[model samples]
Target: DIRDPARPKRLSAVADSNFSFWHSASFNNDGTKMLFTDEWGGGTQPRCRATDKPEWGADAIFTLTNDQMTFRGYYKLPAPQTSQENCVAHNGSLIPVPGRDIMAQGWYQGGVSVFEFTDPARPREIAYFDRGPIDATKMYVGGSWSAYWYNGYIYSSEIARGLDVFELLPGGLLSQNEIDAAKLVHFNELNVQDQQKLVWPASLVVARAFVDQLERSSGLTTDRISAVRQSLTAAEQASGMARRNALTQLATQLESEAGGSSDGAKVRMLASEVREIANVAR
Candidate 1:
């Protein structure tokens, strides 16, 4: 705890045999989990080739409890890079997707990768952007040095190519609703290393995002999912007291359904969001 700047207390420290050099660290939105990157080759060696071990030069996920950290798992770029590309974990920042633990990280000469570690033990990549090595036949250190999610887009700082901006497209893994919901979060200033807590506004889009998650997890029945879609559509079309009434009704129904839902916590959250939206409806 850093409550006292004059005398900062050390919580805990950990190490892994697979990790060569600890480069940087970041926390999840709630700080319940932390991720550390391993700069195995110090950003100047081919550490992501087919023969390279996945555990080396990868990301380590850990869960934090009462300021103490415990190792959970590791995550590395799945695609193998050529020997000519000097690649290893670099820098990244959390993507505010609400209720999920996701990040956009950069790898030297390996490009940018967006992945989720909600499970911690089994982190998986959802999207990525990469370019071939600056020189196909020779190793030239040139790739994303840092990739951070700010506002609604990912801004990457390339070593030799300058800046690159990326937008998440709708796909099987990530829905447009989830992307839209993520865009709702805004930050005036961000320091990826400092790690900030993410707070999403209570809006219909957020509620819909939750519904989409429920569908993905099979947390809600198909009939209930369709009903929610129709109700949200109806509420959006209405105005004034009509919209408020519709949303209020839907929120109440959702709250009642939570008792039987497999993901009751998420259902309650969705209900709370809808209730807040109803309150703000003019």
Candidate 2:
């Protein structure tokens, strides 16, 4: 479904293959090429796993042309014989780096694998960070989900936890040295509680101060505030209780800030109030 305001067209398609179930798809930076996942391999059903027989062998990743969806090539994951259900690129994102040919793919239970797609037609796996071993038969799950290259690091969404950070380096296919070089920066280990304490209240206080300044400069009345409050209330309803409470608190602070006579003093007071709030919240 195209939910964007600029494009409101609905898209639908039919597949010929019974096993054809496109899980996720993404396009290149320039929208020239596209990549998609097909999870119809390794004895697994398209979306269900009823049979125990491992008839299907391997999940495949396919590259396609953006304009016509023309078949380009396929990257069949290595099927090592083990209790593990083999690596399947379930969901992934293309990182657009100027000099890099790497595409970060999320492998279910296989962890995050980076591929050197220099030869686009025949992409090769360069580095892989396995989430390590776990009880397979008991339903071993969890791996990289969404990944984005920002500030020279790959930020991955580890749905089971939070975010896992990694960095890429020069490497060739299946290079353990390259993979080891990439470190895992676990957010939880880095004083996450303290960080949250510092961030949440500060953000609310700053937002409140900004809204107050806008109101003062625009000479907005209670009627305008009521209208914006209504919109905010609707947004809160859509967002849920926690967000609504936070927003309402910010609005209340903004109202208080506007009551102050001096602009600089109001900002300073807001900052001080935020620090107090953070201390209490923490």
Candidate 3:
């Protein structure tokens, strides 16, 4: 906690009793929560082996309250790493996703991991990228140093491989709407230590992305996807309040039948977004 630019003071510190070594940390946008990583066996140690404890080289999420931090849980790379690889949490940063707590982090030879930690105790990876190790035969002290989310893109600085850039695609555990919404968030200035708060606005593009997500996830059948696209197109092409009402009605029907699909909740959410878009058009 550096309150003064020149004179930085430590408010509180956790000891080795809590873990082994403190590597890096990231706080939520509000600064109400903190996530710290444990460098158990150092960067060159393979703490990600099958026999390694999850807490040894993992991220520990803490809920901060009135100068006190409460340990929430741990988030480790689920993938097993070789004893030769430097598999431990290094550095990471938060991705602004409204009320959700999502982060993209770096793990030496473990690779870069993008995950959600809305429920600190139940963090899960959504997207990741990893290539063959520095050398398949041997693992030296070379891997990603930091993986952070800046603006709408993810940047990774490797020790030996140089810089790596990635664009998070909408798939797996995320939807197009979610990705689009996340991209909408921007920062004029970003300092890793001085994290900024994020706010997102609702818009038509977000609604379209939701519909796209539904289609991509197969949440709706091909016929249903086509019908939904046609309806949205017609609503867009139509004129007057009549068109608005028509779109609203279609959205209402979709919302009402949301329970019928495997992704019912998502369908309901998309329907509501469509309805909101219709209202905006009106």
Candidate 4:
């Protein structure tokens, strides 16, 4: 859009019907979508309070089509804040989730939230980090001002506190493989306004991440886990079709046993990834 910076052109104007006040905006990789924030109350009041409307101070995701933007949906911080907490939606940036649309955002005292907007109509939060309000007695007018994902880490500019750094850890809503895949992206310069899409390379790290998740969740049996580790180790050291077949066979066995386990769905899921990894390794 800024092809001619000397005479910048305004392609669109989102008026009051969309939000009360627009604080900041970001574009997804590929520039196919744009996400805007509604800093209701000018970000100095408790706009994230229980009494506030979901759209009053939230991030709205919009898809770009034919040079036109269409409203998708809103992602407000789920946690309710008290009048004493100066909470409201603020700044955010994308988290590189291969094959998916994910973002890490800050909501003043509402805390840091990493979520998925792949399906703009229904965005979901995956991981988060927040502390007790700055002051439980009064509105402190302080919290996270910005949270952006760059390279392999998420950098947050705290209003009162100095800069803070965060890393994505495996959680209920996000798998380790997904997180690892995201980290493959590296941006030399990340200007919030000039957003860019993230692209991740396909590699063994992804497959190993899936193994780590299954190991942590006890999705695999002890013996199966050992076998999987061994096969993966040998395959990494091997450079032949036999290694690929070995991994494939292991994946097949895991898949076959998945339906019989309590965590069958997850097991089957991991097996599929492992299968793909074998093909790549071979």
Candidate 5:
């Protein structure tokens, strides 16, 4: 089922009765359709241990229309258990490349499988990355959860570990050369807490300072500045340390840009007023 966040509308029940157990779903580039993963065959329950039944661990990706929520078709995973147990595509995302559709799906005990979805209805398996032998029976099994493309690199969130960074390269399907090039960097290994605390506030302050300078140089009206101030006020009202800190940083930037006893004297006065509000919020 899909819901329009902006409108009071819903698109639901696009699949047959056979598609009951599903773990995740992702939208195509144009937002016209979506691809969903079904964990088990029709009647099988979630996290089942019975090997007598056809394992039903095979994963299938289905395409559905966005406007009408109609089922277009499906692409089933090829057979043969690559690992100790059967494969299951759990959580994944679709990357939109011009003239091509790429899908990155999480496979329990199968790692991250990247598929070429040129034909939205029938996707082809292109490449995959398997971390190592994963005991799916174990309580604390590790695997990929979410995959996204940012700054020309594929960033995947590991179950327990932080983020695993990968870069796509030209190579065969299971080529270790490309995998070696795609290194995994641990975000938690860095100063995570400190970095998190500075990111939002730092961004807002820098942006506000840049805009203020540009406005001063161009002799533009204070309308834009006033809008930004109002934004900061709203951010301060948000019930989160990160938001309040960001608003405070914005206030500081306004104060710094507003110099003393000069053409910016009025701006300086407004900055002081904003600072007082920020101080109370903090």
Candidate 6:
């Protein structure tokens, strides 16, 4: 612990049987979980071919609690690469999507992948970009070395090619509002090695994003979801106290219903965000 930097103290440490080279690691926005990436081949060997085990050269997830960590599971690139590609986990950063633990990371020659580990035991890929190996018949150490999300877009540092940028598009797994909400979280500077706690501003986009999450999870009834959307729309169209009053009313209603909702925590978060929006509305 760095409680006293003059003399550092070690809290706890654990080992996993699957890890080879502990290349890098990162924590979720809330610090409740941590992810460690294994670079088995040092980014110069073919470690992501069909013959490789998924647990090798993969991300090992662990849950953090009371300064203790417990292994949860492992996540690797779902698609196998050819023996010609030098692929292994490298560097990555979190995508600040509220209420979800999403990440965008690079594999040596596996390109870049954006995935979610909200349920640490069952991580899943949400989006990815991959190219054929540099040489189809021979191994090549040319692919993304780092993939990080900054501002509203993802930037990948390609080892062979130059820098690559990406704009996240709305799809079945993620929505436009969620994207917008993520965009609201801006940083003057970012260091992938040092994880930061992401926070979204009190904006209509963020409130709506929370609502969308509730709808996606069926956290609220269809009628209630529809009504909340309608209210938000109306508030957006109104001005002055009219807007504030509408949001305030809706937030109060949400607060009252959250206890009975399936996703009570999310509903309460929605309520709190909406209430904050009402506070700043003009």
What's the lDDT for all of these models? 0.91, 0.46, 0.79, 0.78, 0.50, 0.91
Overall local distance difference test of candidate 2 = 0.46
TM-score (C-alpha, index-matched) for candidate 5: 0.46
Candidate 6 local lDDT, 95-165, one digit each (tens): 98888999999896899999999999999999999977898977667999999999999999999888999
User: Could you tell me every candidate's TM-score relative to the true structure?
Assistant: 0.95, 0.45, 0.71, 0.73, 0.46, 0.96
Q: lDDT at 102 for candidate 3?
A: 87
RMSD of each: 1.4, 18.6, 5.4, 5.8, 16.3, 1.2
Residue by residue across 1-282, what tens digits does model 4's lDDT show?
A: 679989888787665474888888877777788788888888888888788888778888889987888988998888788888787788888887654578888877777888888778898888888885888886687788889888889998888777889998877667777787878888788886666656555466666665665665687877777877787787788777877887788789888989877667667766777787777764
Clash pairs, candidate 2, are 42-56, 42-57, 43-56
- Report the candidate with higher TM-score, 3 versus 4: 4
Candidate 5: residue 174 lDDT (0-100): 26
Q: Which parts of model 3 are misplaced by more than 4 Å?
A: 1-18, 205-282
Find the candidate with the highest TM-score and give its number. 6
Of 2 and 3, the candidate ranking higher by TM-score: 3
Which residue pairs of candidate 6 clash?
Answer: 1-9
lDDT of 4: 0.78
Give the number of colliding residue pairs in candidate 5.
0
Any runs in candidate 1 off by more than 4 Å, and if so which? none
Q: TM-score of the candidate numbered 2?
A: 0.45
Q: Candidate 1, residues 165-221: lDDT per residue as tens digits?
A: 999998877888889999998889987666766788877788888889899888899
For each predicted model, how many residue pairs clash, with residues at least 3 apart or on different chains? 0, 3, 0, 2, 0, 1
Q: How far is candidate 5 from the true structure (C-alpha RMSD, Å)?
A: 16.3
Q: Tell me model 3's lDDT, rounded to 2 decimals.
A: 0.79
User: Could you tell which candidate, 3 or 6, scores higher by lDDT?
Assistant: 6
Give the runs in model 4 whose Cα sits over 4 Å from its true position.
Answer: 6-13, 16-18, 206-237, 240-282
Query: Which residue pairs collide, candidate 4?
Result: 29-196, 29-197
Candidate 2: Cα lDDT at 3: 66
Ranking by lDDT: 6, 1, 3, 4, 5, 2
